[model samples]
Target: MPIVEELIKEGRIERPGIGVTIVEVTDEMIETYGFPKGVAIYQIMPNGAADKAGLLPRDIIVAVGEKRVETIDELKEEINKYKVGDIVKFTVWRDEKEFVVPIKLQQLGG
Candidate 1:
């Protein structure tokens, strides 16, 4: 199959990833989490970009660079703008405060 051949050739999917399991912050969750708008990170991959950048579970990503993100799709759009090994600054909301973290992108499934 083409999928098998591609896997053999590339070894991995060749997509960039931040190694996070995120969910879109709903209007109700905004009140519950006390964040204006963002994607909620629930799980972090061990030793991955988020982990390396010290992003913890329950942290809400409000922006990528200067672009405000309100959903998982927006976050994906922002992340797709960068390539692997590029450091991207993420605006995070936690404990009713905002902070920035720089994370290096990594190849997904590698």
Candidate 2:
């Protein structure tokens, strides 16, 4: 199993939908992407919940539910507050635009 999967099974991480790989948004990244502090979507998995929700790679996630997340760890921590089948709202920054999207969570191994 992948390390992420193992972590999920061990309850050390939340089971996010196979939607995106995220990285901490640094000042350099902000200058490059023209976004403020947040978690950048490094990659978006095909046919995943985020994909289905129209989230694209390079989109910066600034908030989950009602909490702002500036780091990848904060994003993961916010995600961990919910379980599979829960729908969460995400505030994203893309192409100088900010929008909110709803994504339904899924089991890691599902």
Candidate 3:
């Protein structure tokens, strides 16, 4: 397992889904990834934000609100558009179908 994954398992990173600030990995690292041609790779965190929002672990997040997210930086920037306690919507591709999920935002970095 990756060091970050181990940290998460050891309760070292802030886990917003669990309402813990000391999460093992940031949202950008946990939910987003980089790819050539700007395509993004995604990972589902079991019961994390994306998972709780109905996004599959293998789903690709293409957009957040109106911003196109093709990279982890893009995803973080898009998410920053909203503040804590806000409800944000994301667009993802699952099973070749585009879907939207609206979930409340949470605080990060303690």
Candidate 4:
């Protein structure tokens, strides 16, 4: 099993310096369909903010803060400049033109 929840359940992950759980949020996480992406394919992340943002596995990430990301790495690097609780604008192409989707940043543990 993943260590996060298990650690939390077992009281292993204590807040404020008791070895906090760490979740990795990557760029590929926020994905969308467009450009060379002929078909719709959503990005996946085991530990990511998009997951909590209610983004599905097939949800595409078309835009972020006026920047269009074609790859996962591009997405991660861009969002890194911000922190949790910040509202970010994104264009998600589900079946038609890019649809605007605003996501709130959630802390990806320490």
Backbone N/Cα/C clashes per model: 0, 0, 6, 5
Pick the winner on lDDT between candidates 3 and 4: 3
Off by over 4 Å in 2: 1-14
Where model 4 places Cα greater than 4 Å from the true spot, the runs are 1-54
For residues 1-110, could you state the per-residue lDDT of candidate 2 as single tens digits? 45588688886654666378888888887787577899889887787788889998889999999999998788888987778779999999988888999999876645
Once fitted onto the true fold, the runs of candidate 3 whose alpha carbons sit more than 4 angstroms away are: 1-42
lDDT of 4 by residue, 15-109 (tens): 21101122222434325322333212345354455555555555556556788776555666566655556778867665445677677665555
Error of 1 at 31 (Å): 2.3
Q: What local distance difference test score does each model get?
A: 0.86, 0.83, 0.54, 0.51
Candidate 3 structure quality by residue, lDDT tens digits, 1-110:
45489577866543222121121224554445322122233444445555466654455667778776666656676776666667788776655467778866654633
Quote model 3's TM-score.
0.57
lDDT of 1 by residue, 33-97 (tens): 56678898999999999999999999999999899999888899898877788889999998889
Comparing 2 and 4 on TM-score, the stronger one: 2
TM-score of each: 0.84, 0.81, 0.57, 0.53
Q: Point to the candidate with the largest lDDT.
A: 1
How large is the C-alpha RMSD of every model relative to the true structure?
A: 3.8, 5.1, 11.1, 10.5
Q: What order do you get sorting by TM-score, best first?
A: 1, 2, 3, 4
